[model samples]
Target chain A: MSDYNGQAGDGMNWQPGLRESYIFDRNTIEEIRRAASQGIYDIRGFGAKRKLPHFDDLLFLGASMSRYPLEGYRERCDTSVTLGTRFAKKPIELKIPITIAGMSFGALSGQAKEALGRGATMAGTSTTTGDGGMTEEERGHSEILVYQVLPSRYGMNPDDLRRADAIEVVVGQGAKPGGGGMLLGQKISDRVAEMRNLPKGIDQRSACRHPDWTGPDDLEIKIEEIREITDWEKPIYIKIGASRPYYDTQLAVKAGADVIVLDGMQGGTAATQDVFIEHVGLPTLACIREAVEALQEMGMHREVQLIVSGGIRNGADVAKALALGADAVSIGVAAMIALGDNDPAYADDYAKIGSAAGFYDDWHEGKDPAGISTQDPELSKRLDPELGGRRLNNYLRTMTLETQTLARAAGKSDVHNLEPEDLVALTIEAAAMARVPLAGTDWIPGRSKDGF
Target chain B: MTTATDVEVVDLATTPLRELNQRLHDGAAGGPLRWRIVNPNGAHAVAVGVDAPFEIEIEGHTGYYTAGMNKHAHVRVNGNVGVGCGENIMSGTIHITGNASQACAATGRGGLVIVEGDAAARCGISMKGVEIVVKGSIGHMSAFMAQSGALVVCGDAGDSLGDSIYETHIYVRGSVEGLGADCIEKELKEFHREELGRLLTAAGADAKVDEFKRYGSARRLYNFNIDHAGEY
Candidate 1:
């Protein structure tokens, strides 16, 4: 026994339970084993788990010597953002720059969707309907709601289109840019099945491409059709995953979109193959500059609003995105967490389902202990929409307050005024990706800019 | 235009199409039911959002989404129509005397569409509970991913007919260029023949039900099978 547990650096000693390099880590080994045993890849929810260069690698260059900083409490730091002013008769006006990202009624419980709408309305921001289309509960709760026109067009109708404050034409998603949407059999409730016009207890995969149109040229005609239907009252938004952001953005602008939503790899999905979620699309940090460059080249940077999403957690991430030239930022996973999606209170239930409290990602299974993702009546009963709404409102308020604090520290009267000049990256990768200068120096790496 | 009786004339040249649609929508369930639209020269979204059971006649060619989101209205297009004719309809019928562009009767929930001439690509795509009859040939990928509907094509079908279809009954009279992934020819039994015959009769098409072949989903790709992942 003593020999089996030999100490490190001991000569001629047999080591027990030794592991391979971190490159072939435990999670990787587990995934491979699971795939091999099941004869299928793992499907899960949430964003990319692997670490990448994120907003944490960049820091605000707070006002000093030559710059002037506003007093924290006394000075006002406005955080308002307006979306879709380019073509729509009524552009959405928000009290904060952070909006709620689209999360479908099927992917989430009805209570959760209603709570999100309530919270967003309370925060004076907007919420969006996901692939499954608009629910009456969400519509009643949300003051300003953007309806998504996905490839599937599940539950889509002209009445709902006209009822929407804005319309988002979802060309692709961040988790799987080229991939279609998947709602497992377990998640398809009777109501959801009826809404989507699919059979109950069958795994539904949405179309990867639009049924009518093929390319961007055809897409322009489709957009015109939508505009004609809505009488140009609603702002038409084009959302694309962060693959070929520059080209996609330019195409979206040329298609006469009032807004563009660029989602990065870090964005959450309800259910998708782990491979697609991890391997597809660019990181949020790397995609923003290219998207902004497209808008700048077209001379429509601020004219056609750009909303950045994927991996937005807190005020710092929002400020960083806005600083990188995003008109607004949208959040999904963070909002779910705020609504008690992975609460530790359900740790015992989570363990029963073969997942831990914080690591639970089986959203497609419809066995969510926290009541946010599950369609099961007993499980959904666990969440109180009013309480969840309050929690989300609190979270939104905190993010807004923190953003204002940071803007004041940077001497920006408005949150949108915090530009790339006030930011520096701690790493070369981040510097190159964010197109900002390196800290303690003046080098942007890729291009020759004034900062260098 | 001369012999038609008991009709309300709406000239697109004089009144805006939106205003006409608004008036049509404002009328109650059993109000004035016959309307004749004149001079609709390739205009888009003409006579949209009609909920009542009105009988509307478009005299000439129209652009995209002619008579879209129609409910209970009997809309007749005398000439060729562009993309998405009678899209997302709820009830009633739409008859096109001439050809229809891509995605005719797309995502329609109820009602019937009769294309007297050829229909282009993706006709009846994602159609739900609607019945469409095409007298002439259908282009590529017709009825692609149709959820619940019946598309009866009197003539030949182009490539990849009923690709990724879902529960929709397709009856093609002539040859099919190819079958799409997971879409295959199904046994045309007596019940299917009767269904096709009824649909044809409703659309006033002069095609025999026995001459057509049926196509549907094989149900192989319904679930997330690892073997099928590559095809997707």
Candidate 2:
């Protein structure tokens, strides 16, 4: 099948010159063939590969005559962020606005989890645990770890909850919001089986909903039970995929969350159907304003911290999300990249698995040459946690420095001081979603004249 | 407020729920090991999250998540209990004299839950390793997705007794309305009968093991299949 090199076109009247039909493109034909033969939907890892309106569509408006810009080298731009300030006695204090998002021990290697902990600690930030229970490698290395409470409740015990620095109740994931997690028998090792309390080598299916409770009312009780179990010491966060941000954020707030973690469609998954990842949740840019508006409407914008994730790469994206009113940001796929995932050095090994270096995303296969996403003992030893941690730290430092550069250009001393007026959209779709004016125009599409 | 040797009485009418839980967590370090809570009045999260080994008794009704996530504690509620009673329990003993609400003992792991009266819907839902015995009937969707545990019911069960169950052993003496997808009735083997007899005797229940039927996972849906693509 042909790759996207200007092959697809709108015109399809017995197309000549190798011009492919837009609707029935080469990829679509290949997918149909595979489905007809295999009779199953294609399941893969990674986030949405399709292009959408992103932070790149928004440009920062530097200071000119009306506004004064700060000195590039001399001015200090504060990047510290304090999360979970609404209800917790002990909140997270980060040196940078970026944090490492949750990636499970089962989906990722134990060494990779260790590396993330070591790096986040070096960067003066926190790392989060994912669908699987907390492993000692991460908990022992990480200075501050946020434990996740998912629908499956796998390896969910009171001891881990008490030891966690914070708790995140996962309502849904961005890649598959209403879906459950899938771990093929190939990935469920002896440790994974024991931890999850399931049989060895049996395909595991995580339930989509919490076993005890159903909706918001039950969410309140669940949060309360967690708080009670932890003695009300740790901050409680509610994570929602970007489906209906306005209502979900409000309900999470009402459920007594100290922080809200919003993940968009571009958020990465370990293993899920390809169709659901591409079609489900809203884009990161589309949900930021809506979520921020919900928090602002409740007068809890900064009081209850908002950590936005999915498609976050560098400092510009970080600044754009913050300018759109997010308190902080979380990174998952970027962190994996920082720890040497999909690096060109393993191109030879990747090719053996029927993939190229940058194109390889079969994390669920558990044969990752980089040792980051696999459970194979031999392959896992390829990653040196210390070196991976250093690389991740360097990447995080660079992103922080880049964010400071952007903040200085906008004449701001603190990163959080950047406002919506400092940015303009390069496209109408982005302008409508980000609620920012289009470049060289005073109008934001679909916004009312009264600005309400 | 009794002294050192006596059972301390905490009246929910006068005291706060948080205070009672805190006292329970204190775990006889400063007071008596036995506690009697009065005027529970259907309060949610009553006597929850106590990891310490203590005997807690509630005289009146309690609300959601009562004795939830319990560890090593023995709790008894004389009146009715609300939703998610003894949920995610690690190790404990919970006895309820009155009927229980929905999701009772849901996701409980390694515990013994006994309900003298009927249990509402989704009873023992997703139970990991807990042993639950209900003297009366259970509502619909009981033991749904229950993973390694045993649920015993004396009276009739509602619709969908064991939907999508995994490894959980269900023994019902009375009639079962129906079995759910991926759940089927299994023959009562000798070991199962002995296990049922032991569980019944442990719960102080007077029931014959010969009249009960066992239901468990059919194991057909244990792995994914291309032919059953529509199920997903």
Candidate 3:
């Protein structure tokens, strides 16, 4: 037995070698060299690239011998959601649980904002305003609009606040929590400059924290002030990143917030340092339970609605989030993709800018070939609002159908009835993090009286 | 008692602010030429979103956001305001007879805010094109991250004044505790004195214009300088 030493038959028998560079992988070496040469951190759009525990780790247990399943097409599974019912004089009602997350008009074109509004309106959902301010086009097209009051207060006005159906006071973002917003000089077009009241070609950096308040007590006063200004007709939502969801939710509820918007690390940003996007904040899977626990502890589980965002891509993700105790879910990057971002039709244009179809993340450069993120007039003309709106409507309808299908299989009458009992984790890490029973076992990893 | 002009008097105690504001906002073209609000006992959002070319007279103290988003309206508050006295004023004039709380005239785009008494912290913050004239001192971090326009303080400024400021010009009659990042004292030239004098007259200040020292952007941190990212 010559130990199979014959290499000629195996086509030269090259050994499979692993690169011995932990600190200098190809991508990491490129980043290091780029940072050293440019003397600045790399800034780009999109969410985190590093993988984390997500909804895919959990599986729903369909109806079996003990439970009877509902008919998929016959039995009704309602998905309607009502937000801001706690303190708002008028709460927002949506036919579906999915919403369009905030993306600023400055980061996106006017046509794109209009498209988002039209699509969300047609789909019977709500759209949000992002950093710079609300546009009239967005307001006119959207049936229900959530106006964001950011730290910058760029185009904030009393009239606009009154006009909005709901108000979202943004404390932090998932991409760069506690970091200010950055819109480079190239993106600051004339209209954007006029709206934000900045010079046309100057870089605009928004404030990291609100200038008016320093603590939760002052936030209470500020919320009250907004309430007084709007006569309490609109719902006030507090949006916080997933850094400290438990305490943030508690404080927001204490400050009399009608709704809480929790964005995880996977949430997309128009522009931020690549390092912050990947390294900061908690995973979406880890954020939900803590926020739900906080709300449950305060006896505000259902009284104050919880809207979760950050990497929600489809109906299963929506169902999983709802099962984990979220009232609704919002989407940003997925919506843009459905609206024709990173399309193959613009591959040549992307190639001209040293990028490819699915890898383009230079939204801050103001050269988007798909016309969704850029402010260029010619590029913006490429996107037709009516067509984009139709595509978004189709996507939303599909997601709703998929969610309803899952709910029917689980023998649930309503989508909101999906509970943690119906889900099981595929891995021990997920079981411990999501606090669900591991696959066929009756045990959750960390549920014992003594530490596991 | 009706004034000579087209004056509509509304007592805050009787009329709801929503109804009154709706009437005022909806009827801006056909509404009264002037409005006089009485018995405003620290009411919030008094005379807010008044877009028409009119005049508003508040007889008593107002809460937050008094005359906020005032477009083409002249508002006069007889007593002190709680906070954000003239926030986001587009184009108009807000004259506060008494002291102002934090963030007075914040993010004002195009207007004039005249504070008769002292202003608290973050006064004239993120101000753009709106001239804010304070007759008395301003608290810490006044004019913080101001993008444009001019902030005039007749009295002393608190700590870290004009921090990370942009093109906004800060003129002070009294001492400044310290200059913030990228903020420096500029030589008060003849043109600056003239500008300060005009602002003083507009704000109804009796202080000498030449006694004020000017501070402005040193042109640092205007672009994304890596060395200044720490300040950001």
Candidate 4:
């Protein structure tokens, strides 16, 4: 018999010479070309675009004949969450569990910052500040704001510290855990420069660690200093990228954190090396149980509230996070999307930037057509804060309703009532990471099969 | 918390360090303009984040982050200090009579910190707008990545001086072990000499301007470039 191989194109039979490399695929080839031409690593905005095991890997079993369900229409499913109850004199009380994650005014438009604040306020949740110091517009619009203390210490001051409702000491971000923040020269506007106390139009690389302190012991003193600075009123949250969740969680708790904000690999960034963003940190689902176990081992599960972030998309993700032991969930990219990022309406404008609407993530370029990520005056004016805020509020409400529907179906009167027993994993990898039973089977892969 | 007002000193040995800091902060807006902190006994974050215009003196030793983020307070420590003394000070002064450990005046912005004794590594590291003067020598990595400030060392400087330095000015009277990447000796013009003289007067260090050499950023690495990888 004559040897014959089929010709290949898009999804066609693989041809001999035209076969794609498993190691160096077409996308990989393009990246190589880009690196060869530019002589620099790929620096881009947004989180890891690669697919990872996320909340979708897990599913909830609805109440059946054996387990009774609650009446969805008439019954109530509570969504309220309280954080920072362990230490702060004034703990954050939220109407919903979902909050707006810190997106810097330098990374986003001032209008966008205002919009996020307005939306969070309308939803009765808290909004957070980012690398750049507090903006008047941001503080004025949001009733409750969490000020972030970063490695750079750019515009860190006492007035802003006292003004903040809470203080989050950022150890690392999910996008680049061990790496520092990178702000391209392109995004450094006059206002952004003034806030960061750097020269305008200079590429800024922030520190990877704090200048003054290091380690858990030093962190305890640092936390105390901030508490003293703020008169022990505001909650001090330790936000860390999920690399060693068990050890990091223990260290953060030991460091005197009122709350722990854990971010997974799917978290977004304003700007960072593409390689670092995709390579570092654990996925959100993989991190939760380890963190929960650590907190539980320390007998501080609910005492020190846990807020999970990174890759949170829909109400399903929120419910799954809560089910896995997170007290609350924070959103960044989703909130940006709700603020008109990557919308089909701006498809033509995105094309001008050499991208499609949903495909555009060059936030570091500061040429966002949606006006949410850009610092340009003309581009930023496109977004009216009031309208954007209303849209975000609508999205938050929709998510809350979806969560409530699922919770009622699961017979959970309070959203926090859902537990891991109600969950089943679709994949073995997920079953192992989430420590949940495989669907239609009681096997959790790593755990003993014995029921006792 | 012991408040012995008769001696005009707040004793940290008897008073909780937290209460002392709280008093320092709560009184900053409208508290005592001047006070003495006795028996500091190496307490961390003593007199930190004081916003009000006050003059406080610490009698003994201190631990990490002493007078950190000081806004409007003038604090003086009679004895030695641990790591990160006068970190992130803003519009105030921190004077240490004895030696200081690592990261002295780290990230200080718009304040003056004078260490009579030598400072360990990373003095004035990432300094913003603060002015620091050291009577004795400074350890290695001094003024690394300093953004905007002035670091004056009356004695010698250790290795890797001003590595990856920014706009901050450095003046050293004694020998320099080595200059770090992108750091070069600049001409000590009349302008710099006069500024050095002023800083010297502030630190109370008696050093001739003619004996000192100045160093600053070459500014080559202000923006990223592949050719400058060796420098980084």
Candidate 5:
């Protein structure tokens, strides 16, 4: 076979330009270019994008000469959040604003979900259940668990609903807005099947929509049902895809939701079509502003808490989301990375799976090299839950620290106090959406008379 | 005239439902308290978290989320019910003598719910372990994403019936508009017949055993193959 560069691997006889002209210094770039030339778009596996204006785009607008900074060790900064107060008589008071988003048992093993709960508990935050119903291990480990009620209704139960700290009625996910969940048959182990109440070996198709009501009017009733089931004790959250966010957020609030979770296109999933992930929903940055505007317009900004997810990777991303008007941020892909996904040491096994290092994202397959996303016994054995939980905890702590550092630099004592004025964007689209100045200039195209 | 405590009738009209619930919780009333709830008109979350083993009777049309999260309580609605009636119910019984709106018994874990009239879409969706018996026809996407449980329909079922159903068993006597992806018609074995019979008895329906058809998963798309890469 020819070399990847389309050149023969002759011993000591190869000449320059025998394959092709190379402009980039890194081999990864070359591989990307080669793949792109063949109609394959280089997809994001895990890492910050080079082209986009991420959380680092804005600087902390520190306290001015007139303002005084608090002593690092002496002063206190609170990061707590209360969700679902509108309907529930008693709402959940989270220790931290940062919470773990829902990740299902079918997409990941029971061990992974357990680890997530454990890590979030250690970090003084909350964990969530995904499309699948509540598992004993997940509910037991999480300090404050948010049970998700998706279109699929897998694993849903009254016992779990009563037991949950909060309920999230998921209208749509970011990865595939109008699509259903597809847990390929191979990944459906006996335990998973039992939990989901499906056959042992069958491709599970989660419904794209609820069977009962079709519109917002019906949603109000759905919310009511959940509150009644929980005896109005637990809060209820409404989660929606980023598409048509302004209207969706408004509808969610009108439907009696106490908390609204807006997920953008960058959200990762266990299984979704490549076409849908890349082309379906709006970006998180844009969605946050729209959601915030909707809440602010209704005079229910802080009253109806907004939790934003999709593509948030680090402390900077969390800070940026907060600054963009989000009450808190949820991270899914980053959490998996912290659990040892995309580790270079697993290159050999990745190759065995017909994929090389940095090119493995078929999470639907049970033969995952990273133990976080597989049901296969061999793959799952490669991971140690204790170790994984520790790593995730460490990562969460680091992210919190980074967020605090940014908050302090911006002259704010609390992470939630960071505002949009504290940041600027490098790109025109980002600047317009975030309502900030363009990098290295005072121009704001939408706000200013002279467009940038 | 009957004395206030003569029939042990809980009047939801004059009394706040929460206070009545407290009264029930405190053991002030027992032995199937006859609840005469007047003007139940569209009140969201009317009868939630009722754990007492008593019977409740809603007089008129109830709004969204009626009889939600019920545990060991038998609730009866005299008129039509709104969305998500008896959702996430754990045990006991809920009987709608009239038509039921959307999402009847959605994600219910246990207990038996019987709808005398037509049920809207998403009936018994994501039911963890509940048994639902509908006497009339059901709307689109009924029982979509059901996990484990039993749903018996004496009338026709709407579109995308039993989509992504897990261990849940469905028996329909009437025609099915469509089957959801991966869901297929299965043979009505003896065990299934017995299960349907039990559900019918619970729902107080006199439907015949052979009248209903069974449905389940086809068991394809379990493992990934390079050839099937584009299917998703």
Candidate 6:
């Protein structure tokens, strides 16, 4: 094998043992070198700096000597949650406090959506449609389906609405608020375009805001319209991004929304400007507290269900979200991971795409290596639906089990009963937002006057 | 004229919209009834999926998303309509006798929508395969990011008209204050003139086709070259 350091030189004396000048950390230098070599203006569409507090900073404040712990296997730990009781004629009763958030068929493939529905059904949860209308395959596969009514109003059908288990009125997504949904032209296959009723191979723009309503008052009428259409049978969920969550949540409740789904900045999207994803919205942790506070102020806590999403990765994240006053937690990126997002087996293909194992995020190009987020025929085919579904089921089960473990440790019999008192924050920001005590201290900021 | 046996009138104020829609979905009861929706009362999603080739007439101002996802049926709204009128219609004719709110005929696959009055922002946005003829002015961001199909505005178009358009044809008789990203004015050729004339006649607009200006995509933003990728 030829040595990489061996250089062929004519009449040149070089020393291979001498080291160069040392400066910054080698890892940091490597990052800068890679970035400079790529000459990319700023990595777009992939992971970037998000303002929200990550899962690492938050810790669970498990029950102490004062509380009783439940038996791991013998005691009943109910994870079931009910959503949209304030306005819905029939609230949603979920087997677990985990539901699949809205991911459009236009953004993803029909097979992927079917797999999501299948997995969610197997997990005894609900699946939601995004900007695109309800597909027969997805609806048929999903035991409980939440139809989204977006600003674009693509594929929205009364028949589907009547057939749906619930409806989610999409005001905005976490990735980009007041920003339209984008499915780049390359991924806009004929079928996807047809489903959205747009032209083939064109970047589809879903409207950022509702057309008629300029404020909360008009939203009331809009909500009434949806209720009138569905005959008040299905729950109406109003989803908002984590921008001004306190006010938005209150407005959503005032608008007669049955359920409120709050998404934070870390939420995933099919296509969004990297700038907007990183710079626009608040973190999921901050948003959940504001939403919960708003509901509590109105005495609607647990009466109007609150679902939190964005950056939820594991069972610990789900349990923490519930403890932060969320009735349930929705997962998008984590679900995509379960569908094989960053698997190491596709290293060669990733290299071919000018990326490596942990650096591949070309979701907009439809050339995804892991087969979870791509419209390319070959790439999509790499994902076997059965296997993908099984994997998702396994991941979901593991998360449920982990949540049960945490619940038992917290001396809580029901997962929904997990309250804000069961969590603590390692940072001042998290403590203030989640209304929990600082790590290693029994003092909470607002609850105890002398704590600060 | 079709007989009364072929017509079914439902009062939306009292009758639950779901039951009415269910009846319509189950197929026309007691013959093919031209559903005369009385007392719409700002109700939304009226006659949304009439796939049986029937005709429905709404006599009042309707709320958000009226006649959404229409399929194989003709729907006529006698008064102004709220947001997303005729949204994602597959194949049908939606005639708005009065003004339509924002995103009129948004993402419709195949349909003929004639709006007699002004349409609010984002009119005909992401049009897809629909043909929209607006006799009056449209609001800001009209036709913003339209993917395909034809939008004929007899009156002036608002700011940012046809932003990021792709393969879609926009014909405006009056001034367009602004053009959206990747959208540029195109020469009004003979074919476009004919198309404009046809749309004008269909919409019952008396405006001369020669007066209209056509706009389309510049086609500069399709490929993701390193030079232009950061602009977004």
- Enumerate the chain B TM-scores of all models: 0.95, 0.95, 0.95, 0.95, 0.88, 0.93
**CA lDDT of A165 in candidate 3?**
96
Of 1 and 4, which scores higher on TM-score? Answer: 4
lDDT of 6 by residue, A1-452 (tens): 11211223321443576443333434335557876887543334443343457566788767788878888888999998887778778778888888998888766666678788888889889999987788876898889999998877777666788789999989988888778866777887777777765567766667786644567887786677567556678899999988999999999999998899998888878777666787788888778888998999999888889999888888899899988889998988778778877678888988988877766666777878776667777777887777777787888889998999889989999987787777878887788777788888876677687746
Instruction: Give the candidate number with the greatest lDDT.
Output: 2
Residues A250-279 of candidate 1: C-alpha lDDT, one tens digit per residue: 999998999999999999999988889988
lDDT of 2 by residue, B1-232 (tens): 5555688899999998878887787763656778899999988899888887778899999999999999988999999999999999999899999999999999888889999999999999988899999999999999988889899999988899888788999999999998877889998999899889988998899899988999998887778887655544
Report fnat, model 5: 0.66
Residue-pair clashes, model 2: 0
Docking class for model 4 is: medium
As for lDDT, the candidate ahead, 1 or 6, is 1
In model 4 chain A, where is the ten-residue run with the lowest total lDDT?
A: A1-10
> What fnat does each of the candidate structures reach?
0.46, 0.56, 0.46, 0.61, 0.66, 0.32
Q: In candidate 4, which residue pairs clash? A: none
lDDT of each: 0.88, 0.89, 0.88, 0.89, 0.78, 0.79
Candidate 5 stretches with Cα past 4 Å from truth are: A1-53, A61-77, A84-87, A449-452, B1-8, B17-39, B126-129, B145-150, B155-189, B196-207, B210-232
Which residue ranges in model 4 land beyond 4 Å of their true spot? A1-19, A449-452, B1-7, B29-31
Candidate 2 Cα misplacement greater than 4 A, ranges: A1-16, A448-452, B1-4, B28-30
Q: Candidates ranked by DockQ, best first? A: 2, 4, 1, 3, 5, 6
- The DockQ score of candidate 5 comes to 0.43
RMSD of each: 4.4, 2.6, 4.9, 3.7, 5.3, 5.9
Which CAPRI tier for candidate 3? acceptable
Per-residue lDDT of model 4, residues A1-452, tens digit only: 11111112444544667766555665676789999999988887889888788899999999998877889877989999888898899999999999899889889999999999999999999999998889998999998899999988888887899999999999988888888887777788999988877789887778898887878998998898888777789999999998999999999999999899999989999888889988899988899999999999999999999999999989999999999999999999999999999989988999998899887888988899999888989999989999999989999988888888788889999999988988999998899899999999989987865732
Please give the TM-score that candidate 6 achieves against the real structure: 0.85
Best by TM-score: 2
lDDT of 4 at A238: 96
Q: Model 6 over residues B104-217: C-alpha lDDT tens digits?
A: 887776779999999989898877778999999998887766767899988899899887676789999888988887889999998888888888888789899888889998
> Per-residue CA lDDT of candidate 1, range B1-232, in tens?
3223467788999988767766676653445678989999898888777767788999999998888888788999999999888888878899999999999998888899999999999999988888999999999988888889799999999998888787899999999999887899999998898899899888888878778889998988777778787755
